[model samples]
Structure formats: C-alpha cells, structure tokens
Target: MLRSFSYVTDHTGFCGTIKNSASDFVVTEIEVPEHLLRDTRAESLQKTSEAQLEPSSLCLQQPKKQRTEPPSPCAEGCHGGAPSPSERDPSCAGGDCSASPNKKQPEGEPELRSGLEEASMLDSLLGKPMSELLNKFACDLKDAWDLENNADAATREFSLGPILDKKDRADLHSAVRQKFPFLVTVTKDNEMIVKGNADYRELCQLVTEKETSDFFKFLDAKIENSTFSFAPDGNKEHRKVVHHFINRKFGRLLETKSFTVTDVNDQPNMSIMVRFREKSWSRKRSAGGFQEKQDLYTDFSYTGIKDKKAITYQPMVVKKVTPERLKEIGSKMEKKGMRIHNIHSACQHLRLGQLKGNHFDIVVRDLKHHSHDSSADLKERISEAMENVETKGFVNYYGPQRFGQGQNVQTDQIGLALLNEKMVKAVKLFFTPEDTDDPVNNAKRYFLQTEDAKGTLVMLPEFKVREKMLLRALNRYGVNHEGCTKGWLNIPHSMRIFYIHAYCSKIWNEAASYRLKIYGSKVVEGDLVFSEENDESVSLNDKVHVVTAPEESANKYSIKQVVLPMVGHSIKYPSNKVGQWYHERLSKDELQMCKFRVSPLQLNIPGCYRPILKNVQNLSYFLEGSEKGIEIEDNHLNAPKVSLHVSFDLDPSCYATVCLREIMKCDF
Candidate 1:
C-alpha cells in the first residue's frame, strides 16, 4: 500500500503538506481554500483593481450536493487532505475582502509608516507648496523677539500691496524689518502700523508706490539740515541725545529751516542765522559838559566893545618950518627976471625959492600981439633971446603935488622955481664953421689939431647970400681940405677938393696918430715886405714861393719866390694860406701858420699844394724829399721812410679802394 499525506492552505495562499514513506500514497490534487485564494488574488491585484465584490452573490451559486456534505478521501487514503469548498472558512469570502496582504503589515509597522507619511506630507505642504506659512512664522517670531528686546520697538500694522500673495508679503515684511528695524511693523486691518510721530504720519500719508521708492530721499535731506548742539561738559551720550532729539522733533522741519548748526572755532553750541538784516549806527558821540552850552552859530563872537567917548587925540607934526622959509618965492623970482606965459608955466614955477641953489632969466611971450615991447614988447625981446633954449623950471619940485577932487596933502608939495640961462646962451652962440668968414682957417683953429692937419676945411655952408658968396670964392680957389663940406659945391675944383678934404679929414679925425704894430710876415706884390712896424734886427733865410690865384679861376700858379720872413727864428706866412702844405715839408707849428694863411680862393684853386691835396695823389716821394731836404739819398727811398707811402695810401684807401688781397683770403 502507498503511504498517505496531508496539506493545509492559509489566507496568504501558501500551503503546508505531510507524507508517510511506508504507505507510498500521495494527496496529489491539494487546492487552496477558496477564501484564502480570493483574499490573496485581491491583494495581488490591488495595484489594478479597486472595486469591491459582494459576498452574497458568491455564496448563492454553490451546488446542492456540495452543500450536503463535505467530500472525503478514497481508500487509497490520505488522512489530511485539501479542504472542500463547503468546509473552507466563510470569513475569507470576497466583498470588500480582507485587507490586502501586501498592505497588511505587522503590528507597529502600519503605525510607523502612517507617522512617517504624515511627517513627509506636512514638510511638503509647509516648506515648498505653502512656503508663505513658513515665512509668516519666521517673521512673527522675529517681530515678537524684537518687541521683547527693545523698549522703543512696537508692534504695528504695515501694508503690503494687494497683489502681494501671502509669501510675497511675508518676504517683504522680513526684508523691511531687517533693513529698517525700528520702522518694521506688522499689518493691522490691512494697513501697515508705521511707527512715526505726527510728521512721520504726514509723510506716511504722502507715500505712494513712487514715494516709497524714494522714501530715503526725505530722510537724507532731513539729516543734512538737522543740527545738534552739545554742552561744554557734555559727553558723547549727551551729544547722541541731542542728535536724536534733533533728528526726531525737527527732523522734517530742519529741511525747511534756513540756518544750520555748525562748529565755529571748535565750539559746537552755536547757531548760524542765514538771513540777516542791514542797519547803520553812528560812530561818533556828542560832547558832554556840566554848564549850559551857548547857541552855536557860524558868526558867533566873544570879545565885547568899548565906548567911543574914550578916544583921545595923539599929536603929530602936521607941518614944519625951515630957516630958509621963503614964501611966494616963485613970484619974487618972477619980479626979478622971470614971468609966466601960460598956465602950464605958472604951475611949473609955483612957490619956489631962489637963494644960492638956482638962478633964472624967464621970458613970457604974448603970441596974440606982435608989437615990439609994450607989455608985449618986453616979452618979444626976451622970447627972441630965449628961443630954442632949455630953461630950468620947477615941476612940483617938492616931491609930487596933487590938486583934484578928494585930493588931500598926502604927498609933500613944496614948490620950486629955478632960472638956468646957460642953455639959452649956448643956443645963441651955436653956429657951424661955414658961418664964419674964413671957414678953413676957422676949422683949423677950432676943430682940427694943428701939427697933424693936412686937408682943407669942408664946411656944411647954408644956402644964404653970404654962404653963396663964400661958395663962389671956394669954386675959384679950392678951400684948404680939413673938415666936411657943407651945401652943394657946383664948381668941379671945389667938389674935388671937398671930396679929398672929406677923405683925409675922416682918417685924421677918427684914427690915432701912431701906426698899427705888425707881428708876422708881411707880403706885398708876391714879395715879403719889410715892415717898419716890426723889430729891425731880425733876418729871413729860407726861400718861399708866393702862391696866388685869380679869385674866379680854378688854377693857382706860383707868382714869385721870396725869402720867408722870420720872427725871431721862425718863418711866418700870411694868415690866408696856413693849410696849404704837405705834412712832411712842414712842422706842425709851420703848418699851423700856413693853415692860418689859406684863403677860400686858395682852397678853391685846383693843382694847389695843400695838406688835403696829399689825400688825392700818390705824392709820397715829394713829401719824403721835402721833409729830408734835397741831400737825402735815393737808397733811403726803400727804407722805412718808404713805409710812409703805404700808410698814406692806406689812409685814403679807407675811403676809395678795396684790398684784393684781403678779399681773396676771406673765409666766407
């Protein structure tokens, strides 16, 4: 007999079997329990199938015979066999089914997996998908901490735009708080809680999208204008307080203030007023005194007046009397021999004395009457005698006298009359020599010196009858020539004699009798004249040529040869020819004398030997021979004396010629 075996199936679809070796029998058709099969298939297909099955439908379809009894094993006999359908546990039937086997983890496994899944879901939702929550949390935590840390920090609403999602608002809030810690605030009622005073509130009202972008601009302008003052003893803390106060209270007002605070000379507690006013003040003060001051006027005076009655007379010498007091002295003189003819003469001779000082012989003429000496007869006699005469008369002889309107005796007026008859006698005796009977004899006796007289007198005779008679006599026989002739001489002899007389008379009358003394050489007719005016002891030896030329001609020819006149040992020439010789032939002294003798005629004469002539010619040989005399040898011509020709050529060449040698040797 075959040995028998048995097997059992679990809900997971895994089966267990037992076998005996002696029997050699096997349970070959072992099936899993239906409930276990259904459960396992459902778990296996869980990834694909999700719909649930009903358990009632599966139970209703079971066979009647199968339901009556469970099937048993045959005689071959396996004692434990696969359970029949009816014998399988109904708990495993399918509907929603047993939990999927793969999903049916062990006790703590499901809880642990659920816990990890929850944690992962939360991390995804909060970190990536809902990052706004994370940002909000972070911002809230920072804000709370700041509030707790700083007393000045307060919670307030801050507005983010409506376009800003939760995440953007959270991010912006965080950024704002980080950047401006004191200004950061949370939103309350959709508006930001900006921490500021009334001015800041006003600024907040002004904020827009563009204004927010430039929010720091106003702050910068305020900071620029704000001024902080510190006390002398103030420390840094005091300065900081002052700075804060200034930055807050007047932070916005400072932007509009005209003045600012600056340290002047290292002192910080000062304010500068930018707007100033101009005014003027006096620089001088009035004088002060105790007594009342007098009224000031331009014409004010101080000295008082005195009474006019106090005046007293001081006597002065109004007039003085002299020992020679002669009154009506002019009339006394007039009674003696003088009388006036006119008012002018009377005024001229008023109150004058005669005495020893002056004498008078006066005549007055009555021009209206011509009878010879009645009252006018005596006047005519005196007038004829006094004609053409200068008579002495007084003219306010005591200083100057004045007699006119408002004229007082400011000047002395002692009148004087005088008689001077000498001028009248001189006039009466005046007559030319021609008026005499013998004019030549008269001129000789009166006007001409006796021993030196040579010419006849030629008087200026009048054209009267007596002068005509004398003239006719002179025409017959010429008068002795001595003086000037008067009137016309019609006769030729008389005229000729008059001219000669006039000529000689001029010479004798004006010139001295002695001769003019001559010092130098004298020449007459190309020969040296021995002058009687010079010393007779001197002699001349050397020969000289007298050079003369016509005044209008251009050529000079030697006129004659004469001994050179010498004064002492020196030769002399005429002053007209002083410059007309070569330098070699004459010493400077002799040349000077010759130069003095050079006249303009000689200078103009061509071919004449002059010092300047050497400049125009090559006469060096002549100059040398003349200097050394004719005895000099010809051999000496080649000596250094010949070099003088070179010097003379060079001197004139400066003005005339160019040196070819020098030109050829020139570098340029």
Candidate 2:
C-alpha cells in the first residue's frame, strides 16, 4: 500500500497530478539495434588495468594492516546498548580493521615466506589452470587496489574453481592474502573467491564516442567476448540468473550442465557449466573436429521450476500468416487497450527485456502551487526540479503496478502465503474483495459469503479466465487445502511467478531505501556490483562482486553500479549494516536465507541483485495548454491549469511512474 522509497536528489519537486486520461501516458518500446542483437555473448574475465603497472604502495608492497576479520554486523551490539566483544577490541573497530589497522598480518617477510611455502603446497594440489586463475586474481587484486587509490571502483570476484579439500581451500585463502595482502577471500559452495576491485575506469573507457557504427561494433564485440560459462566456478544464483536470462530470451537454444559432487566437508556441492547447445547436424559433421569434448556426466538434469499450465514451445507449421489474421489480432488487442504495429517477419520470437529502452510521453494534468506564486515562478521551480532529475537521477523502485492495482490483498501477500505453504490461505487472499462495486468484486464477495464455487463462477465475467479456472477447480475439488492448492496450481506459471517476483520487489525496495538512507548514494565497503549485465534478470548466477575496501574502490563506482539483493538462498549479503538489515527484515517474515524455496511447489527463488539508481535518457519537459478539467487557473478564477508535458527514455523494466514520482516529489 503506499510504501515510501528513497530519492536520489534533494529538490523541491514540482507538485502535480498525472494520468488524467488514457492518452495522458504514452509509452513506446525502444528496440535494441539489430547489430547489437547479432552479438550477445557474455563478457570475459577482467583484464589487469594499466594502472597496475604504476608504482603504487597497494600494489608493490604488502600493507602492514591487512583486513582479515569478517565485518561484524552487530558492531554496535544486538541486545543492550553495550558493544560486543568484537566491537570492544581495537583490532575489530567498526568491523573494518583486522588486528589494529597498523598490526602486520604475519609480522614480517620471514612469516610471508613461510606462508608462501603453504601457498605452494596448496597451489600444487589445485592444478595449473586453477592455480593460474588464483595468480590472475592476485594480479586483479593489485590492479583493483591501484585503481581504487587513483579512481574509485567496485570489486570483481575471481574463482579458483572448486577446492574439494577444506584444509586446502582454507590454506589457500590464508596464503593468498599473505602473498597478495590487498586481496580478500571468501568461500562459497567449496569454491574460493578472490575478491578484488573491478576497474570502473575501464567500464568508462569501453564507452566509445562514435555512436552510429564503431560504438555498436565495439559494444557487440565486448558482449560477445563476455563470460557466460560457470563450468567450475561462480555463485549458483549468478549462474541461474544468466541461465534464466538466456533460456527466456533464446528459448531452448542453449544447454547447461549441473554436476552434484561431494566436497571434503562431506556436503554435496554443485558445479554448473553453461554453453550453447551444438546443433545435431553440426555434431554429426564435426565428429573429428570436436574430439576434445568436456565430460558432461550428471546425476540428474535440472528441471528448474515448472509451470504445469505453461504452453510448451512447439514447432509451428504455418505457411504464412495472412494480413487479415494480423488485422484480426490487432483489433482484438486494441479492445484491450493495446496496439500492435511494426509487423515484420523475424527468424525468431521476441523475448522479454530484449528492448534497449522505453520512451515515455507523460502528461501531468493539474499542477498545484502556492496562491502567491506566479506562473513564471512555478515554471522556474519545475524547470529546476527537472534539471535535478537529469543530473542526479532517481531511485529505481518498482512502481505500485508491481504490487497490485487497487486490490485489498497485495500480490506479495499471496506470494508469502504460497511460500509459507498455506495454499488455502493464498487462494483466499487472491479472491479477497477489492472493496469495489465491479462484477469481479461481487463474485469475490459471493465466493467468500457462500462456499459455492459454481455460484461464484456464474457471477464472474467471461474475460476473467483465471478466476473462472480457480472456481471450476474449487467446485470439483472442494474448498479444503488440497483443493485450494490444486486450484492454485491450475493458474498460469507466469502469474504465479509474478506474485513471487512482486514479493521480491517489495524486499528490494525496502533494502534499497535502507541503503540510500544509510549511505546516501555513496558506494561503501561491502557494497555489491554486477560483474556482468543480465538485464535485471532474477536468475543472476551470482556474477556479483563485493567491495573489499571502500577507500580503494568506492570512488571507482557510480551510484548506478551499486545494487541490493532480492534476498534468497544463493545470494551473499553485503558485509555491512544493510546486509544485517536483510536478516532482520526476513526474520520478521519468519523466513531465513535457506528457506527461500518452497520444495513442495518446486518454487526456488534464488534472488538476484537490482541497481539502486537509474539515469534517465533524453529527458525534456514543457507546459501544455490547460485541459477542460482544470479546477484552478493562473489568476483566471479557474482550477490549476499547468498541464505539464514530460518526455524521457528509460531502460527496459524501469518504471516511468517512479521517475515521474521523483520529478513531482509527491505520492501519486
């Protein structure tokens, strides 16, 4: 219901109303360039920045103070006002210090040499490629430190594959830091991650000035070389995000392998490898050429979450779709307030989030202003607010549409019920009355008052397909938990996932607000940044990096790079207060990090990260002629006549409503 999200800019926003009519809000999808679409390969490993060659203290010499301790979430204490033991010790002050910021990690080069001996033992066990990867990470760490000092940046995580040996992984973690004191190491699913800052300056450099041809070419090449495989490394969520994005965008054009192997800890660990599925004909023709195939033996193929009601992707046998058929479809869509145009033949179907951006032409109806303020003064103030939006941008909160539109029960509430496995409760919440006089609400009331599903079905309109299905299922199965669950399952998979995603969006908004409140757009230590762009997909297979040291990395990242997690089993919480808030917030919901899955329904929400801020493109605003509905006028004894016309472009999935809310600085 009216949750408050943080703002990026501090400006006296132009107070106004919007969406007075259907024509008031116009949106057009910005198609991705065909050239860019030709090449969509993921990015490669980050190269060592040129700054690494410079003689920086962080790179050349081991800093005496190497941060070794984990950040204490409760540095200020949990229960009483007293600080915890870790907080009391000077060695762990602010959770940023290791052992007194001046204390040497191993005390000298003699100890460092001994640590190297330990490193050698571990390196021998890791094999050449993984060992080389570790070394690469060390170089990356040096580069990060060097870059952080010169320019603020975010960290990128490097994998040392999966270290099956617990002792070896631990030794490597300790020894690697001893050798490269600037680096921080973390273990995830038996894999070692060498945390180093990513060079955001390189991110900036990748943006070329030549837009028409050369820039698109470079961008396409850059994306093509990008990494999508997580054969032996990467966070499961990160891999899943990539996997889901690819799967959703390209259908079943690619294949991935998930290997479940036990580690030294006697726990099953997953190693997934994602690659393009070779065409059957290609495999037959290249028998000799593709000899060295990676062994893809597996325990079981991961089915992921399946929606029983989803339409199976099948080969369509169509000679040609007639113009009359297209017109028929267009007419049907127009009745539903949607228009389909730009008809063309395509080799493939268009997938979600394939667009470059969206262009918005929003018209604000009644503008409220002080009685004493003149039209020119109001225009100046509005112009100033618009400028602030262009410069500082706005928080990219999921707008109210994501929650639910004028409903008594939010989608997330139903999602929470589903997650809690109270299927009957979830079904009940879905059918809850919206306090409206519409036929749908009347049907809901009839269903609630009388347990006659058949009667409710009679009252529902023909357009209410989901409602009718649910009622029919209930009429057949009865109103018990078993019946309700079966009825719920009858709903489309897309709608079920939408409810769940809405719940995720709720958490993301809260987390984003907390982060903004705590840090105020500042990238701090332990903040997360995406190693690759997945176009805001939830199946982010953990391709995220932790900011190891803010002083060295914060300056390198813009507010756009910083992101907050959606909170799931596969995600790593930030090693700071915001991360702590995730736990505290989830605790209130009676949920834990490991409980993000509803095993019975096969619903696994391995959450992904979302950027806190989004910069608008091609923003422009102007005052339009007064509409007839104006209640107040500019010294003309009429209503507010300032009909503000605003236009801007935003990346796909971004909310124009949120952007408008930011500009207006009012709850709409």
Q: What is the Cα-based lDDT of residue 63 in candidate 2? A: 33
Q: Write the per-residue lDDT of candidate 2 for residues 522-628, one digit (tens) a residue.
A: 78888887766544222243567787684436387777888777766556788889999988987787676446655454454655567788889999976766655
lDDT tens digits by residue: candidate 1, 566-647: 1111233433332222222234223323322111111100011111101112211111322345433433232222211111
Overall local distance difference test of candidate 1? 0.22
- lDDT at 13, model 1: 13
Question: How far does residue 338 in candidate 2 sit from its true spot (Å)?
Answer: 5.1
Looking at candidate 1, the ten consecutive residues that score lowest on lDDT are 345-354
- For each candidate, what TM-score against the reference? 0.10, 0.56
